[model samples]
Target: MNWTDSLEIAIALDEAHPDISPLTVGFVDLREMVMALAEFEDEAEKSGEKILEAIQMNWIEERE
Candidate 1:
């Protein structure tokens, strides 16, 4: 999944880190986590703040 696959990334993140709070995640860490996901496949330099924010927002929604 790439930057556009925010919901998928969020789901993976939730499953991978169920103990963590999305609200406390920084963009840098979030990006790294996304890149670390086994299903993730994208250019590392293609991500930006907007993509990270979208991922974080979806992660928050997933927790709720």
Candidate 2:
């Protein structure tokens, strides 16, 4: 799957398992949130690069 797909999966899972106050299930930590965002951004950047590469080649490819 692509980075977008991974991000979508993460969001969907989070939504479906929404955290409970007493549990960590749906808890959203500021730090973790930032980290996840940054990580996603970084991964997304890779996706862009991959897209560029494919474009330059006049083809399509998925991130490895």
Candidate 3:
């Protein structure tokens, strides 16, 4: 998934880190976790604060 696929990334993150809260993860760690996903295939340099925020917001919604 690319940087634009925030919902998909959030879903993957939810599944991969069931015990972890997205609110607790900083952008740096979040980016690393996203890059580590088996399904993720995007350039690390493409991510920015807005994209990260979207992913985090989606992940929080997923948990709720």
Candidate 4:
């Protein structure tokens, strides 16, 4: 999924890291984790703080 696919990425992250807390994760770690996902396929350099924040927010919502 691309950077714009926040819900899909969040779902993947939730399933991949059920025990981890998204709220405690830093943007750097979060980006790495997203890049590591098998389904993720996007330009590495395309991600910006805004997209990362959206993904993080979605992940937090997924947890709740």
Top of the candidates by TM-score = 3
Candidate 4 residue lDDT tens string, 3-30: 9999899999999999999999998999
Q: Report the lDDT tens digits of candidate 2 across residue range 30-64.
A: 22332354333433334444433332222111111
Backbone collisions counted per model: 0, 1, 0, 0
TM-score of candidate 1 on Cα atoms, chains taken together: 0.97
Which regions in candidate 4 have their CA more than 4 angstroms from the true location? none
Q: Write the per-residue lDDT of candidate 1 for residues 1-64, one digit (tens) a residue.
A: 8889999999999999999999999999998999999999999899999999999999999999
Model 3 bad stretches (over 4 Å):
none
Clashing pairs for predicted structure model 4, backbone only: none
For model 4 the TM-score comes to 0.96
Best by lDDT: 3
TM-score of 3: 0.98
For every model shown, what is its TM-score relative to the native structure?
0.97, 0.24, 0.98, 0.96
User: lDDT of each structure?
Assistant: 0.95, 0.33, 0.97, 0.95
Model 2 pairs whose backbones collide: 19-26
